[model samples]
Target: MGDITGDTRLQSRILEDVGAASHYRAWLVSLALDALGDEPVEIGSGHGDYAAEWLPHARSFTATDADESRVAFLKERFAGDSRVRVRKLLLPSTLDGGFSSAVAYNVLEHIPDDVAALRSMAAMVRPGGAVIVFVPAFPLLMSDFDRAVGHVRRYRRASLRKAFEDAGLRPRVLKHVNWAGFFAWLLMMRLLRGVPRDSLALRTYDRLIVPAVRASERLMAPPFGQSLLAIADV
Candidate 1:
């Protein structure tokens, strides 16, 4: 909805974080790819990062996004890789019941009609196929950063589960993540009432604080932190 694709600084920071999280990203990709099995289509494939990650595992990959520039970038980036294809697509209509599974990571919150979007994602998948989603959690933790990025809502497990159910999908897993970081974000939003402007401070927090919190995730479970992850079957 916003010109987020032009925010090079935010995009760089996000991609850097994704690349650094070998364990977490691998886990997420594994879940989605496993659900997909030999499926060949991917929905909302912004920048094709996840598509690249899952390419080796999938039989073929058709990456689609609403953003035409992103689609062109992905097409050029994966041009030599014949197994991957990129195209511009709107939800529900463009999807039109073609994919074996659909993945909408960190995308749903950006849409106002989150439930309808989930249904559209579900429609893309064939029967028995899955939809994997990731969203920031806790309304109390929503911040200026979220507003800038065009997030319509944050989520809790119950709300997330209900959303999937409303979309006619069966929720397989709905859990909270980033437990340690949750407290930090909560404090920042609820108490500080503003986002920190220091890039160095943010980097230090991500590099140092994230690992410690993620390590704690092994012991602690849902309702822990600031993210909600879900896998649902259509």
Candidate 2:
């Protein structure tokens, strides 16, 4: 892992915090999982946090990442799990396709050419299969946090639809999520200048605020949010 980036402590911290804010992220991951087919391939599976949730549902779950270090970590993490296979696959590469579904969570923004990346995801899936993606929403919310995480850009509903369309996929579901988190992000990252290190406040937001908005978002799609979830058929 040090080969990719010399900062081992940062890597360790990131892995440790993989699913800390699980209330909202788990909901999003579950939504993506339910949309997948039997043979689903999860691309850019960082730390295998969310991937672990859906692996049992997939008849053949191939967890892939372009980063060799991340793939190695995933392999070791799931060493005894026969249902999952971890592979090092750079996107838009010439590997065997014909998968039932392709999933990418919080990854499209990292790619400089997201449209091409989406095209590759669609190409990997078999016809009639779908490509599901979760991305940060609202370009206006592209804060220092996004840049710190190596995000090149954010996506709006129209822009997200256009990306899938440009990749030759038909958009079936596209909506804003984390409506409450949108305001929270604005307050913390923008107004407050990063989330305070106070653990109790963070827990309150995650345990209470997140679930409340998540349930409400299910009943009605919010006009704006901190993230977008899209399901596009190939």
RMSD in order of candidates: 3.7, 3.1
Give stretches of model 1 more than 4 Å off: 1-24, 92-94, 187-220
The Cα error of candidate 1 at residue 126, in Å, is 1.5
- Candidate of highest TM-score: 2
Error of 1 at 109 (Å): 0.2
| Clash pairs detected, candidate 2 | none
Model 1 C-alpha lDDT per residue in residues 46-100, reported as the tens digit of each score? 7777788988888777887766666777889899988877877654443565667
**Candidate 1 whole-model C-alpha lDDT, 0 to 1:** 0.71
- Candidate 1 to truth, TM: 0.80
What's model 2's lDDT at 121?
A: 85
lDDT of candidate 1 at residue 165, scale 0 to 100: 87
